[model samples]
Target: MAGILVVNERYFPDDELEPAQVGATSFSRSALRCLWNAGLSAGVILYKRAEELTEPQIDLTHRSGFRCATLRFNFDMGADTVSRAIAEAAARLCAAYGFSSRAMLYYQTDALLVFHPQELACCVTHHGPFVHDFVETFSARETAQAFGDAAKALHLFKHQELGVNSVRSNGRMFVLQHSQLQREYLISRGVDERRIRAIRPPIAPPTVSEPLRDERLRSFVEGAELLVFTAVARLDYFKNVELLVSGCVQARKQGVPLRILVVGDSAEDDVARQALRAHVPEELSAEFMAVGKLTKSQLYALFSLARSNGIFVCPSRYETLGITPLEAALSGVCTLMTDSEKVEARRFFPDAHRFLPSGDGLADAIGLAYASPSGVEQLGKELREAIATEISEENFERDTLSAWSYFSQSARQLDS
Candidate 1:
């Protein structure tokens, strides 16, 4: 089989991936889905934690359209463990997939594990090792790390010396960055800007089985000429609900008739949400509403109702996809986001919408939008159209296949 060897860090059946598993889960699924559509026979290598597997062994699981190779290793223990597992798994996967020893073409969801020349893959940048620790999804990592210019210079130098997943891109490899900020980061690190493509993953369209049944929300929407700003995230430090609180307070003081509706809670408990509620001043209580978590359909219906005068805000301290804003755009609401460097999806919005990740900055952004209602609403419509076109399934399949073809061609040329 002269097909690509598709790989990812996690395992989820191609069609049955969950919403919580969005970033890493979807990365390889999109590639495998496109490769299958192209009539390519590929093997998927899924990496899981060492503890999850009973023993350290490679299991070849056959799926509907492709072969899967599951390899387990304690990635926390560092590169040696990962290298051994990948080396063993790659050998078996190459042999099983009929990939010639001379040319091994990989379509990696994250082109991070390159113990071989299989580094020439169409890789998604958001999941790449270069920015993994920086994204900081966990509260423990929220304090921040020393990401000075020298943040990855030593790391990249080590990888370059080992000829493993080097960011010093040659013309042979393809890197799809989720945002222009990421592309700029790569360019600064010596990748050619021409070879770098920026495209955010499409948020899967919401499927609503639940109806919008909240009377409180209905009355709020029906009340005065209110601008509904929705923010969705588990109530946690990483989500930065503090920024939302501060921003909402400022927006109201500036006479912007706005209602802040938050859509998620800390998955385990409402402690964080309660803390957030208490953090809001007593007088501002009526304006800020945490409607609690709603099902997919209910949420979208809520957005649809508020679409006329709605704006979605993501004030996360750091994020990769910024899914809420994307979903909001799909529901015909414009997006206001924190720094582009913090949330990759911020790249899709104009400068007016991408605010500094601070309370005052957010208030100013909201003030600007309130000042020009018609323009902001029209911009919402334009953004909705742009997201539909730019992040469509058709475009993802096309881009994935195109990169696969490019990598395949380059690998064969090397073999020749």
Candidate 2:
């Protein structure tokens, strides 16, 4: 077997991703560690679609004890052409890093930018297809929010079709689906079941981080009968911000006294933030307030406050094993998530706070936390214990490495 090469299109070396908010980068980071532990060399290959760079640029650099190679190209090309370009880039990186032609390539993002698996020993992890969010939140997305146009939506849909086509595209290529719903979807799209592995995203207990301190947030929590903490990495349409506000409206009408502390920024889609605020009535404006981006430490500090009077809520239309809910559960806050089979929470988390993705359902779920605070607290403890007992760092690492090894070893067999 040769070394491993991890590739993710969204990964940029310069960006700082909070550990709690990002699971893809962490999984790639952990893959490097696991490979090193097995006495094999490993490196990361970042591929991105950049229309601004004008010219394609691919370079290698050593960063933070890891060998990193980056490829930046434009996205307007044909799907087959883009996939071929990425595969060629990985082949070149493998040779430069002293890996054989058949080096194991772990494609981290479901961008499905690489389809020529026969030319590369690959295992594509379907984090999610861009089209999933595009269609799910179509009505909610405003023209400025990136998915409102017919051309772009069709563009995403086209690639999603091609991307799913590669689930069983090659004999040597294996696929990993992060959620069961995604796996079923792929199967429905004619992907071979033999090549796909279903693995939920791993959850680890969060380390202590600084508490989020804001005077405005402090005052709101002070007057709240129940505190609901929500962490939005980006206030995008798929995050379903309107749904959150609408649910709060329903709850407030029923006289459910609560305050939702939202920590995130709408920098990616300011329109989403604007639309969310518009959905709120003046009477219940304080019921839901978004306190923009906070540091990791500050978020933990916020999570700690929830141990007594708070719970975490994820109101996403499409979620691929979101790390926030699990992290909050570990912090002893009952983590509530929108009920969807595609969500990992539905499979792993307790049903105590699971809510239908609607106004009345979301409101009722919040009411459950408000009416039986102790029950919510106990659910948090139970979730923490159950996940901790079943999926530890050691076990998660082992399972990840084993999946790669199984595919890599198969590639070697075919070569022999």
The whole-model lDDT of each prediction reads 0.60, 0.66
Model 1 clashing residue pairs (backbone): 208-297
- Write down the RMSD of all candidates, one decimal each: 5.7, 3.8
Residue 322 Cα positional deviation in candidate 1, in Å, after optimal superposition: 3.4
**Model 2 stretches astray by more than 4 angstroms:** 2-10, 15-23, 50-56, 75-101, 110-117, 130-148, 213-223, 266-270, 295-297, 373-375
Per-residue C-alpha lDDT of model 2 across residues 1-416, encoded as one tens digit per residue: 45555555454344343433344655565556777677665566777668887555677766546667777777665556665655666666667667665566677754553445456667777664456543554453442254546677676667767666665566776776666666766777677787776554555555765554676776676667777668866666656766777787788788877776666663354555665677878877757777565555566677776766776888876666676676677777777788876465566666766899898999998887777746666767776776666555676666766776777777777787
Residue pairs with colliding backbones in model 2 are: 209-297, 210-297, 210-298, 211-298, 211-301, 212-298
TM-scores of the models, in the order given: 0.71, 0.83
Residue-level error in angstroms, candidate 2, position 242: 2.0
* Best-performing candidate as measured by lDDT: 2
Per residue, candidate 1 scores C-alpha lDDT tens digits across 327-373 of: 78866776787874656677666676678888899998888876775
What's the lDDT of the predicted structure labeled candidate 1? 0.60
Summed over model 2, clashes come to: 6
